[model samples]
Target chain A: MFDNPERTNLEQLGEFGLIDHITKAVELKEPSTVKGIGDDAAVLDFSGKKMLVSTDLLLEGIHFDLRYVPLKHLGYKAVQVNLSDIYAMNGIASQITFSIGLSSKFPLEAVEEIYAGALLACQKYGVDLVGGDTSASVQGLVISVTSIGHADGEAVVYRSGAQVGDLICVSGDLGGAYVGLQLLEREKRIFLENPNIQPDLEGKDYIVERQLKPEARKDVVELLARLGIKPTAMIDISDGLASEILHICRASGKGCKLYEDKIPIDPMTYETAREFGIDPTVCALNGGEDYELLFTIRQADYEQVKGQPDISVIGHVTDADGGYELISKSGNVHPITAQGWNAFTSR
Target chain B: MFDNPERTNLEQLGEFGLIDHITKAVELKEPSTVKGIGDDAAVLDFSGKKMLVSTDLLLEGIHFDLRYVPLKHLGYKAVQVNLSDIYAMNGIASQITFSIGLSSKFPLEAVEEIYAGALLACQKYGVDLVGGDTSASVQGLVISVTSIGHADGEAVVYRSGAQVGDLICVSGDLGGAYVGLQLLEREKRIFLENPNIQPDLEGKDYIVERQLKPEARKDVVELLARLGIKPTAMIDISDGLASEILHICRASGKGCKLYEDKIPIDPMTYETAREFGIDPTVCALNGGEDYELLFTIRQADYEQVKGQPDISVIGHVTDADGGYELISKSGNVHPITAQGWNAFTSR
Candidate 1:
């Protein structure tokens, strides 16, 4: 509890005072904490495990639409996505620091709800909520999460390791989240246009759920560890399979050849895409927010994952001379293009 | 260079496409990087040293005046402040992850400048610019930095370790940054009134720089180490001294007695405070952003720091019943109050 003797002001005390005031109460619990408050960063000892680190931000209106987007899910998703980054690095998150910028619209309950979600996520993931910051925004809510993780030194995979001829694979199907978003937007339009319309969402449960309550592929990471196969390269299917593959291609100094027939799309996702008059494969290719694992493995290790139910091999890496191309079932080869979200993008 | 053959729209490609496009060109240099780009976070080898971790966020109007504040300093300070936190933890930084919410007002160069500042700080701190996320913000620029560092097992300090009668010490001086801020605001007002009058900033270099570029007290940690002394507890002076002390009192479950005369104020800072019609002591006590180190040391280690020029021993810890008190120059004791910046106090 704070003692408000004279009703002190933050501006009068300034930013430094606010930071010191808030942080001064934190205490170190372990000897591994060599330094805590005066240096460039906090230092720690994690025995011999590899270090993991990642950061992500949630912007109002862009990443989330506050109307139906609960504050709890927002907080949970902020931490989860950052932790997902650590998982993408093949690491187990141990600590996280979260930062938030909220407008006057936020009440005490709103902030607490956000923390509730974050705390719930921490408990679910077995990670500690280490530290964070909160501030007032001019107009919207913004949350940024940074997670620290630990992994075995030998078990980590990276996007740059996709050698020529490495088998490109993905965990589960994609495009469900995108289709789900489409369904939500459609419902949003109907609700906004006329309040009398009973939302026709009874049949689109899977797609809508995928859009609203997306889960990080934490299960896949544990499953991979248990299955005893480390991918040569890996990335999360956040934007789409095509875009993520290009990331691997450029990073590994190689090219990718993806099979349209092999691209996995959920039945619900396929149906929703057709209903929206979009190709299900295209939705899987370029749709965002899948949060699935896309990875490359050496051909020799295909035997390790041959009949796994959750995994599918969609393509193979090749030398750069072959170019970044997508092979369609009808023998059509199309060059991939860049079309991910860009802030500077005028459109 | 990107081959911008077909100018695909970002909204069409969506968030996933953007992530892939942005990450496509990254080639990680460290072999210690076990996995990257796909998981919850990036994984790096521990490499035998203790680690450090810190996170900080910079909001647009609250943290900086964009009219004069350059993007590079914003980026640099964002990283620097977090690094400073690690330093406060008595650790050496190794890795950092950044997440940014950029407004449409900024062009690519603005982002580059911010990163340039971040890069400079990384080079200075010997840390890797490992991973980050950049996304659109409807409001203003938001930069959040999460830094990791390593600390020796023996030298770590926490706020909860203060004992009854440990000497309170602070590195460097305070109030200069606050005074400097007053000057900046005053000048800003003048400039807004009429763009003709130049800023009357003669002989005001120290305070202005203090506001513009406050360095973290990294040297104090090294000096203390060299003096063969370990602080019982430590925190950086991001907030004011009163708030920081209150934090120590709450965390350590103890009270403290501070001497008004013992508080450190640089001569320039003192003069500036007076010029602004502020009590220099109050300014020093309540002003924030000094980025100095506030710590406590045992009585036995008194001789080790007694002769240090930059350090000041201001008070001592006491039992909970003693209560937090400050002895004035007139030999009058006043019970300490926990009053500092409150973001909601004004709103």
Candidate 2:
């Protein structure tokens, strides 16, 4: 995906030259963006509104394997993940600063491809590319994106607001990204073993795409606003469902009762998990990188969200004294354990 | 400086636990910071002012050698450099997001020391540590800091506002950081050759400190404001003075004439440069990481700043056709060339 006919060495361009080259075509779309690329810092005006800020760092081997992950998709996913945090706060992302520490092994064309993917995401989300720093690294590519957003003071949501009667809701299906990762890793190993074979990704487009280029749930935030429903507490499902649920519960000083049967899993995700000899429910509970919104709403607002096509009412909030439990499909209860991604040990 | 008796593996704490431990003492001081460190994203209110945003990526080997650099000073310098960009725009920085990608070599205590230094900087500057990501790196440590600040619409400065007759001025002294780096590198080489030999850093405290913990000139920004002198064009001298001058000249469609003798160089820096068999003028011209403000003021405002103790009037801006030149003390004029730190090619 990153093959280019004419490759220019990065050293020939230097830092300033490379910056001028990459930002030459940048077009700012937000009126609030008073100043963009060239200045020491990007100037913005968010008068009368509250601002939201979040940052995420992605390392080459730890967060991704460049042998399988395309630079374009990596760039796009980096921005999407940071934007997911903003959407989790019920805010609209307005600007982003995309900085990279790239090694010389990457040519100018590779960096340009990464920027192309980043700009595409900004175009799609209406977020302005403000300012960033590009420095040479000794190892592989390192991407750090900081997203800025704005929202009305009263409309912003936090994870510590859920009440005992709040309904635990989630947007879109779960576990597809994890299943997709397994497919990619399996194919990568197979390809390494036998170079003659192509990747067996023919019929797994949905799951594969879910892993390669996950989208932030901006539509769900808009939908909630249109329906006049505000989540009492919210968080993006980057760490598996179990871990995120625990975070919300701990922050809100409450407990949660999650229903395994109510969790929405796509048919492809379920079949793939079974093929891998893994329980589908376990994947839904522990698999991560869904980029979906997990939120809680007041019981009085249940009527407004129950029938929504994209949202599923999977569980309910409970008192702090009540332990966090997951109701199994067979009418048995199990303690919710966080088996989410631990970067230090797992990778 | 980084000797910790109790060493705990990072894997034992996990990501969330490490973050909680590092940021446990972070006290938010900015009134605009509505919420910090715990939510999906930080919340701030820049209701009546323009916001300035900038990001920088610092890699371990390329930016600093950990063998000689203490983690605490590295963390502090990283924040100082990013804040320098905001101050270069004549903005008062209010918040920052500091993210790090660490390898297994770093223990929990080392990471804590880094955070301690970062928190100290935030406290001194009255900026809040809002939100950031902590991930495991496959190689050396990587830091990414995003600083956010506010400025009045009319008070903010840009690089593209210089005129034909603007006076070029600089804050504090130059070349000390570069000379300090040379001293450190020489000592590092000597120590590696024989472990028994201590570093010969006697009588070089000023230059060594300049390289280890350079301060951002926020005082200059305040001084400019106090004197009611708004710069016509401005940039922080992260790169050499020649490169920064070229940036302003290219952006503003003007040329410049810098007086070599007028450039500020500390006495220790000059003597050290002589000891290293390098010209003091060359060190002042090409040495980077000064973290000083290099700006241009209208000739009419020159009287207000000429006698300032820390500010030096280096030269004057000229028409685009005049070209960028430097006048030597020996009555020789030569075109100024940029030999700044080119990360891709130099290292």
Candidate 3:
């Protein structure tokens, strides 16, 4: 996607020089930030709050395909994925360390494009770009991000906190990102077969954007706090709704009953799944990378979030012997299974 | 190097199962770690202390050659390199996130070997293995580590605090790791040339250990704190002594006069460099990956460190106009340059 003719060779600027060029404009905005960018390590002082940290590594072929993914969007998505982990804990992300391994094929402008996307995400999330390491890769690009966040000790949520009778809720719609991926992959194959024909993604803006630049649910955390409602358990939906719900069930030693009709699926996503010969319910259950918040709250707090516009109450926690099940719209119950993305398998 | 006859395929156990298998034995030793593995994010409470964070990415074939390097050693070195950055800031590393991307060729036992070494390092350094991401790579191994550390606000040091006439000092010996790398490369070539012949690496224990498993100088930070002596400026020597000194000079806006005779070099390193037909002083100057702490202390406080065993007084700082210079043992002055590892360049 990088067709800039005036590309500068990366070798012209050494590693230290490249770091200086990219981070020269960094301005730390957090009062807790004591040092950033130019130091051996970023320094921060968060006295009363508990610290939260999460890291993710994205490989070129396994985690992403550059043939259809833009470098800038890849950078933005990488940061969002890590920040999603922090937000899942009901914490406020404050800083991130972004490290990348680039092959010789990448030019200085390509790296700049990626950094611009990363910086843009940081700006939107109010996170400071702290410290990172840059190195050369043998073949393809590798992106690693570590997000640091903080929350009051009492406010932090864990996956093992869910209790029986809690209401299961999710923010925003699901299956959109998976449908977007299918469209992009189909377009990529067509373009490779015939370079002259343009991709037919004319009216698929919402799904495509959902796949390319999905946003973390930082606003959901803020909204819940504003409503004086705290989730008993929470997790970000990166590995499908089924997998995340199972994570909570396994951790909390409880079972769940999910209502299929209550699962929110965007119209575009449903239509696209039909076109791809896939079930919309299956897509919503197993499609990953939605970046939405899946959580549970006490039954007493149901009135606080009952009519929220973006929040959907999909199910409720049950006793361990009830087992994990999905009650279909037609009144049939099916056992829930986690068939989320398993990178080790070639499926 | 993994030649087990009955190797277990990684696909047999999915990503979550693999993570559980590898980290099941991890015991949290730090009181600050409120939560560790098996969570969306690790939680820590470093109350009343300034937090330091750093990250590093290491790729196969680019950062290391698996043909000569052991997987366990690679894992150990990756964690050590990141911890070195924390110690450079005069902090105590307490927690780390270790993420890796493995290809299909690697068996489950191979990954366990790497984690074993990583756990060993964590046990030795009193750092907790908190959380990480594991995925599959298309080709080679990819390792990324993020180290979290803490120090009292008053005890933290920075690279930009050096003053004119400050004494430049470095801990431990230099050039050993570089020479050790040379020895390993020579043996690899010899083995490649003759399949049936055994390569030789006799009586090179110290230098080889330095290269294969370099330790972070956490002890130096503790020693300085115990002596009630804080460095005016400090940095870890990862990109060679010359590069690190220049970093201090550039950040502090000062010049330095490094004495070639005062640069500490192990006797085995000196002999090995001569045997390889290389200049010992040049190796000491530009050879990287030593993992030693280089710092500057005020002249008035020099008395505290003058009689220390492993520390050496290499030079003194000067006004910016004096420029960075190295006075050779033969009385000739030469400008210092950073010929450190530039990943983009083949050299």
The best candidate by TM-score is 3
Task: Give the alpha carbon lDDT tens digit for every residue of A160-183 in model 1.
Answer: 888998899998889998898888
Candidate 2 stretches with Cα past 4 Å from truth are: A1-5, B1-5
Local lDDT at B53 for model 1: 73
Please give, as one word, the docking class of candidate 3: high
Residue A103 CA error for candidate 2 (Å)?
A: 1.1
Chain B only, TM-score of each candidate: 0.87, 0.98, 0.98
Q: For model 3, how does the per-residue alpha-carbon lDDT over A128-233 read when each residue is reduced to its tens digit?
A: 9998988888868999999999999999999998999999999999999999999999999999999998999988999999999999999999999999999999
Cα lDDT tens digits for candidate 2, A168-284: 999999999999999999999999999899999999999999999999999999999999999999999998899999999999999999999999999999999999998888878
Put down candidate 1 lDDT per residue, B100-159, tens digits, no spaces. Answer: 777555554465667777777776666676778878777788888887666667766777
Candidate 3 DockQ, CA atoms: 0.88
Docking class of 1: acceptable
Q: Candidate 1, which segments miss by more than 4 Å at Cα?
A: A1-44, B1-41
Ranking by DockQ: 3, 2, 1
lDDT for model 1, on a 0 to 1 scale?
A: 0.76
Measured against the true structure, the TM-scores of the candidates, in listed sequence, are: 0.89, 0.98, 0.99
